[model samples]
Target: MTSVVPVLNDSMVAGYLERFITEELHSSGFTEASIAVSGGLDSAVVLKLACDALGTAHVHPVFLPYKASSEESRRDAGAIVSACGLAWTELDITAMADAYVALEPGIDRLRTGNLLARLRMAVIFDQSKKEHSLVIGTSNKSELLVGYSTWYGDMACAMMPIGDLYKTQVRSLAAFMGVPQQIIEKPPSADLWTGQTDEAEIGVTYDTLDQVLFLLVDQRLSPEEVAQQGFEAGVVRAVERKIVSSQFKRVLPPIAKTSQRTVATDFLYPRDWCT
Candidate 1:
């Protein structure tokens, strides 16, 4: 059978997202956008969209790299920034990260990676403040659904233009937008450590993961039903588990109700609400 995931019309998606970036920023009373570019496909797509929507002068792209970050990352990041006609800006987080890493001698790669991500998050927000821009997140649907990202770390952002698009779809849009072939083709990684790829950590390739996600989430198929679609039951269940577990990353923190109206529950106001 053909792939269960739908192929996107790149041109249409591009136009819609460009408008999305523009309207989202304008609605929030902001005219500038700040992005954390990882030299990866998602960020490349977001950066390009922001530039198209608001112009190069209005979009500020910054590269935040840890000491162990790949040289390839730096090179690809530079290429995309130059392609967008924006001046290259990067900040090294090694010193900031290592300062805390030294406190805990036995901290493993997982903790260290989270530290780096949060550090990058802190820096990006500061940079956004310095430039008076809103932070545009680069996470795709696959990572967000599977809980593959660090919460309040890489996930913290003013808005996510590609948050709804899956990894496979993002790749298609990236190609259409003429993002560098090397960045699009590179194995997806957070670059937390040497030779680490997202697939290796997630235990599934995006091609398969995205298909399973479409069936289970978008199609709303039961685990058994998805398994019947020629997918291994084990993989189906694993994806379901991820979606269930990572759900916290998708929404606001829960509040224990003591009063009649509680923040984030009943006292919520629209994001664009004017006082």
Candidate 2:
């Protein structure tokens, strides 16, 4: 059988996502959007879509960097700001992150990285409130499926225009939007620490992961079935484990069903209650 993942029409996806974002924000009574950009392809694509959705003036691009973040990342972020003529905000989060580190001098790299991610989200939300804007999300489906995202950190957002797109599709859309080649060609990273690349940490390139995920997730294949398609058993198992374990991060905090109409239980309703 041919690959289940359909070849994307970049232009159509871009138009669809941009319209989705603009319409959702307007319906929510928010005329502005604030997004944190890491100078990575995902954020760059989001930045472009937001700017196209609601003009540059109404889109706020925030770059929150810690001390270990690469200089190249900063330059690339600046390049985007310049190219889009956006009023970018540079907030150095090094001091703040260090304070937490100091409190626990021997904390591991993973802990420190999570702190940095959450700190950045805090900054994004703060900026959104200051500008009366909604926090836009840049996470892609591959990250979401593989449990690669930091919960309540990078995952906390008022809206996620790119959440449904995989990392591969993100690149396709980014190229369609004329995102800088430097960004598109660079290795993907969260810039949480020195020499940290996402694929390295994940132990699989996005192209490989996305393919298996397309079979496992979108196609809803059994792990055995996916492995039968020539995927390594170890990889299929690992990917399935991630999707199962990360279920909490993908949903609302579960409330105890003590009452008959508990929120998130029987009382489920659209957040835009009136609309």
Specify the highest-lDDT model's number: 1
Q: Pick the candidate with the highest TM-score.
A: 1
Collision count of model 1: 0
Q: TM-score of predicted model 1?
A: 0.98
Give the alpha carbon lDDT tens digit for every residue of 1-275 in model 1. 57789999999999999999999899999999999998888899999999999999899998998989999999999889989999867899999899998999999999999999999999999999999999999999999999999999999998889999999999999999999899999999989999999999988889999999999989999999999989889988988999999999898889899999999888979877878
Q: Which RMSD values do the candidates have, in order?
A: 0.9, 1.5
Write the residue-wise lDDT of candidate 2 on 1-275 in tens digits. Answer: 44456679988888898899998899899999998988888888999998988999899999998999999999889877777889789999999989889999899989988999999999999999999999999999999988898999999998889898889888888888888899999999988889999899988888878888999888889999999998888988988888899999998898877876888778868856675
TM-score of every candidate relative to the true structure = 0.98, 0.96
Which residue ranges in model 2 land beyond 4 Å of their true spot?
Answer: 1-4
Stretches of candidate 1 above 4 Å error? none
* Alpha-carbon lDDT, every model: 0.93, 0.89
| Native RMSD of candidate 1 (Å) | 0.9
**How many pairs collide in each candidate, listed in order?**
0, 0
